[model samples]
Target: MLYLCIVNQTASQNAEEFGFHAGDIVQQWLWDDDVDDSICTKIEDLTGEDLVDEDYGTAVDGVVIWWRDGDDEDTLADTIVDATTMLEDNGPVWVLAPKPGRPGAASSSTVQSAAKTAGMNAATPLTVSKDWNGIRLRAFGKGR
Candidate 1:
């Protein structure tokens, strides 16, 4: 199955000591511009990957889109940017799976609790990490 990993580049850069470099690709695209034409084109051109508009939503801002293709990880970057990027980016943030029954799926309550335990304040934006089931809270704020 395939999984989508969305991230906010700006936030990710600010929160982490290691910032995004030339290879990092986020899942979101500017909402105001021609989402299909402008953003998708940029993704295709920059990352050599195609964008599918079927997953479009108000929450999506940028993405480090990923999916499994025959046991191979398909996406644009090497370093896994920290979750802080989402807060700075203001993403409705989402993960799109190619099929159901993915191993990473987690309950909403679990995500909330995990975030809280990590000192993720309500004022901070949320960052979701994709696991085998679906979504998991990776980090909250500029976690050291």
Candidate 2:
């Protein structure tokens, strides 16, 4: 008798570097004009998750929200609330904004304040792409 085994080895080894895991549902919100396809592809490939572009109001594992510095704080807070509301329990929200030297770049402190106003805790920043930086935030308790 002959024995045969099947194995899958194409999985990315750096998925965790981007804070992603297999089967995670990532929703991307575009508030800026620049979009990097390479970065998007890498995210999907590494995480093995579906990168959705629409806001369906359903629970998601994570959210990638891109915005500019000029965006109004009130509006940004509102948007963050809405976005975090749709996330699953313990799901993270990544707020991506322009880098410091880029046009319409928002300071990290400003982003942190906005997240706080939205009832979310802003974590340290990360590089999302060549032109954008991201800050991870988590929603407050259910009541908030």
Candidate 3:
């Protein structure tokens, strides 16, 4: 498992890094144009299910929030909370943001602070793409 966590890994090689499972119904929060497309495709491929963003008519297995610096405002907590409406019990909320030194990157402290405010615990982060890093936020007592 540790060997699979290296940076610059292919989409499939990094699937476990995001904890995706087969048939998972992952809800997409906000998709900025700058978001990495390969990661999304890999998720769909690995799960054999398309990511759902509209209607949210069913309980979702997990959520992916494409975040940026501006998204870390007071609403960050609100957004995180809102994203949890239909989440599975102990479901994860992945906050993907630009890496440090990149435009619109949210600081690690800021991301963790918002997660705390939203009543979630930010877990070990993963490299989502060359320019993006992701933090897996879990409800207390919910994740590894």
Best candidate per TM-score, number? 3
**Candidates in order: C-alpha RMSD to true structure:** 14.8, 7.4, 3.1
Model 1 over residues 1-144: C-alpha lDDT tens digits?
122223455333232211222333344321322122432344445544444342343232334332222322212112113222433343323322223344433334433444455444222223322221222223355333
Model 3 stretches astray by more than 4 angstroms: 1-14
TM-score for all predictions? 0.24, 0.78, 0.86
What C-alpha lDDT does candidate 2 achieve relative to the native structure?
Answer: 0.72
Sort order, TM-score high to low = 3, 2, 1
TM-score of 3: 0.86
Which residue pairs show collisions in model 2? none
Highest lDDT model number: 3
lDDT of each: 0.32, 0.72, 0.82
Q: What order do candidates take by lDDT, descending? A: 3, 2, 1
| After superposition, candidate 2 runs with Cα above 4 Å error | 1-15, 140-144
Query: In angstroms, how far off is 138's CA in candidate 2?
Result: 2.2
Across 1-144, the per-residue lDDT of candidate 2 in tens digits comes to 122221212222243445667778878876444765655677787668768874566678877787788888777788888777777866767888888899878888888898899988887877766777878887665331
